[model samples]
Target chain A: MQDLGIRVLLEGNNMIRLLDGLWVTVRISLLAVVISIVMGILLGMVMTLKNPVTKALTRIYLEFIRIMPQLVLLFLIYFGAAKAFNIHISGELSAVIVFTLWGTAEMGDLVRGALISIPKHQYDSSAALGLTGIQIYRYIIIPQTLRRLIPLAINLVTRMIKTTSLIVLIGVVEVLKVGQQIIEASRYTAPSAALWIYGTVFFLYFIVCFPISKLSGKLEKRWQN
Target chain B: MSKTDYLLEIKNLEKSFEGGTKVLKDFSFSVQTGEVVVILGPSGCGKSTLLRCINGLEPIQAGTILLDGQSITDGKTKWSQIRQKIGMVFQSYDLFPHMTVFENILLGPLKVQGRTREEAGIAGEKLLERVGLLEKKDAYPRQLSGGQKQRVAIVRALMMEPEIMLFDEVTAALDPEMVREVLDVILELARGGMTMLIVTHEMQFARAIADRILFLDEGQIVESAAPEDFFGHPETERAQRFLNIFQFEK
Candidate 1:
């Protein structure tokens, strides 16, 4: 109690609860990221096609996700849709759905940019070598695109992790929610715990995000050089 | 037994950009086996575009192309398979930057033709040696000079043992000193009896290497003649004017 309310976390199972809360955040984000990456790559390739119908459709999807705020999307899917359709979804499920949709668009656009970023000569030379369209993509285009893509994609993962913090507003008991609960529950006993609690929460997020950012930076420098 | 005497032939070829500007218009030409044909043209005169169409790099607005006396549009002929026989080198020396010279040279033979490493490697190294690039096989494209990279690109094209090689201003992008190094390789190839279609601005080199000279203007062959005649006595006014520009430069 005297030591900046550090005793609150030191007390029975409060630290464990915070860790469990963090796991929820990690679970949702990682699941969404995985799905996003797989679908996003195909979507990206499709976006590069010269077909007009495909162009129009992908543009609308990308624009919709780009224009709408994630918080609003979450409410639309979780609360609005549920009430209108007489359906129910777990808060975690709704969070994952919204994030996956958002993340996929971001990742797809990155992939499309990467594919287009390849020099026109690369395709010409490969085609001149008698590589089929599929073979050209597999042998030359994808490898180069992957080299250009990995660092950016890793950065996207970090964004997803940080963004998962917003899910708590939808009643998901993620780390921030746990921290808030801890602050409210110990208000009388630990009047000063808010500072320490919020500080620890911020520290937790920094630890998770900083290494990912650093890893992406390191890869970018190494690969580009 | 042969359906056509020419190794490569194009009839009524037409190419335009977005149906707007015509790069090539009704071009009809042929390259015989063991022949070296040099195309000389002003900028935007369809010289490079002509090479690109021969290699099937451009979609024809209307035309027929015959390779090795066979119609390319026979439906039985796969374009990918057809391209394997028609090797092409670009002005930029479009080598894969991520690959070493050996990797770049051998990719066509190994991946496209499905040749064994032993078979392709021996041929690849021999061509590298011929181009005076044997020692640079392990070097990446970024590590090589402009001349060295162009030589590697030639080696890459030769690895497939193409029947006819299309050189689209291959030396145009090189420095003055490096240009000779690349032209020397083509000269040696011609001397060795490799049939070649070359688009080049190097007048002296064109005179030295070409069996026939095609003087192009506005997407048509203004004059086609033996190199000696084309250089010494250009037939058409266009050819004379084109050659005069080079003489004035000297």
Candidate 2:
């Protein structure tokens, strides 16, 4: 048990490396979430327009992103596209790009669902009250949409944070990658290190995600009232 | 009546659904300034569609709608500008559920017309007071009873200071006991000499408030007469049959 490499995390600056990895994971996820929300909201609004061309184009893009797995998308950006296009994309940048692509599609669909779920009478009533299209959206539609959107978006943020572990596959050195490094380095001296290191990684992810899930649940309940 | 005296006029109005189901064909009517005109019809007879067309909520295929002598149905017409002068209340109330009653009323004046919150608030208070809902100004639509929601909806329209008001069966969705409160608001507006085109099923309220009643059938006005004449002695066979349904309900 003493050789189990739990000491590797508790003994020295090994834990500091894990904290640094956690920071990197959080930074990428945050950047992705912010960019996704802005782009996704604009795309979602475009999807709501009655124009056939825009509707078809957005539908295709949404389906493409949704159907493709995130890991494949990351590899395409990092390895496949880099070789095909002769562009030197860094692993971190590729991870950010892939996660943002995934998040934006999801966020856009959420926004579209929220916007369309509004009753037709609401639009008719606002128009009859003399509101212009922009005014109708600003004063009536958006306020209602945001109320239905925030909790769902927060859930997406949690999902994005968890999915960041996949970045380690492409050599980004996130928390999971750092845990693998620690386990590999102690393989001979601490033969049982794999279980301890992986357990810590799991604990780290839970600590980050559990509070967010709780917050999302709280928001859902508050909005229902 | 002269053209100048008419607050609203619909000439040869034609409306069809997406699949080419003709809802209104060659429908023509006019409401005089300060007169209360009530429209009565069976469901799907285009009474609601007619009101929606006049408010530009539903675009007409071919027609001319003149509001205060301006061609509202013309291609160049700015519908938002025309809607400012024409207030409309629907059967569903359609109050913004997320907003308080005061916010709902003030939205038109503040957002569309660009008035200050205080200015809209003052006018909103007056309308709320008139409807006896001054205290409910802070309450949301979900908190209000069906009658209160309808009354607040009326006040929301009135906040815009519209020249002509349209009611598309505003009390139709209410409970039987709650219907009178909404009708009372419409009656008050009529007595105040507001120009109104109302669609309703309440025969007693229509008799009390309407200067003229248009009985519609098959998307056309089968009979147009005073409320007493329409109720007591319907002119057309379709009108008599429509009235008989109400008689049976009574």
Candidate 3:
């Protein structure tokens, strides 16, 4: 336990590496979230269109993303697609692409559910009030949809942040990868280094995610009232 | 092109839901400016559908609707433009639940008509004051009673300064005690000389406020007459039977 103290974490610039890896994880997750939200909202609105072709196409895309595992998607994009297309893609870029694809579908479904849950009379009333389609969405529909969406979307964001830890398998050198390196290096000197290293990474993830989960809970309660 | 007499005209309007359930069939009616026309019908009898067709909420398969002699049923007609002059109140009192009463009243005028918030607010306050709900300006719809919500819905429509208003069983969902407040608001609007087409089930209220009553059955206007004649001597057996049902319920 003494060897598992602060000294182990501070050894040979190990702390710096873990911090850098944590930064990478946060950056990737945040970037993916922003992209997913913007694209997801638009796609979700498209999903609500009455056109059968549009609905069918979006359904296919959403189902494909939902059914496939994110890790497999990561490997397909990073290794398989790169080799097949003969294009070079970085590990971090691949992680972003994979997570954005996953997050967009999740967020889009969330948005679609929120938008459709609005009562039919609300649309009829807005139309009767001389509002154009755009005005109706902007002034009435979207605001209500967003209020229903924020808490759920925040939950999705936290999920994305935690899921980003999986990127280490693709060689992104995120926090888990950094922890693995620290554990590998101290394996000879400290037999219990793996426990401490993995524990630290677990705590780091909890430190970031706990607040967001709490926030999502608060928002859900407030909106429910 | 000539000066039109009627504020609204419906000629041979036809509407049907999918799976071949006809809601309105060859329905024709008209309302003179400042006239109150009440539609009386049984449930599923297309009274609500006719009002929906007038406001462009339901597309008609055939026939034309003219607001002030201008065709509003055509594809070329801009619905938003036509809707600007036609206000509607629903049975459900569909006030935007997320918005304050002030915001609900001000939204149509400010967003669609491009009125400043201050200008809209002034008009909104006047309408609210007229309804004696000026204190509820900041109150959300969920905080209001059924009567208050319906009143707010009426004021929200009036905020657009529409030439004509349509009420589709506006009091059907209100509590027994709350119904009078909403009816009173409509009565006040009628007294103010606003042209209105109302679909309602309240027999006494209809007899009180309606200039003429149109009895609809099976998607057709079976009888159109002055309120006194319609109530005193209904033309058709269906109309008599319909009124009898209401009388029995009362």
Model 3: residues >4 Å from true position, as ranges?
A1-4, A75-90, A210-225, B18-21, B74-77
TM-score of chain B of each: 0.96, 0.96, 0.97
DockQ of every model listed?
Answer: 0.56, 0.67, 0.64
State which candidate has the highest lDDT: 3
Model 2, B1-250: lDDT tens per residue?
Answer: 2358778888999999899999999988888999999999999999999999998899789989888777887777688988989999999999998888988898889877989998788888888999999999898898999999999999999999999999999888899999989999989999899999999999899899999999888798888999899888888888888888867542
- Model 1 C-alpha lDDT per residue in residues B101-170, reported as the tens digit of each score: 9999889888899999999999988888888889998988988999999989888988889999999989
- The sequence of per-residue lDDT tens digits that candidate 3 reaches over residues B1-250 is 4458988988988899988899988878889999999999988999888889888888789998888888887777789988989999999999998888998999888888999988888889999999999998998899999999999999999999999999999999989999999999999999999999999999999999999999988999899999999999998999998888867442
> For candidate 2, lDDT tens digit of each residue in A49-113?
99999999999989999899899999999999889999989999998899889888899999999
The candidate that achieves the highest DockQ relative to the unseen native structure? 2
lDDT of 2 at A153: 91
Off by over 4 Å in 1: A1-4, A83-86, B1-5, B12-26
Model 3, residue A155: C-alpha shift (Å): 0.9
TM-score of 1: 0.91
Could you give the candidate ranking by lDDT, starting with the highest? Answer: 3, 2, 1
TM-score of every candidate: 0.91, 0.89, 0.90
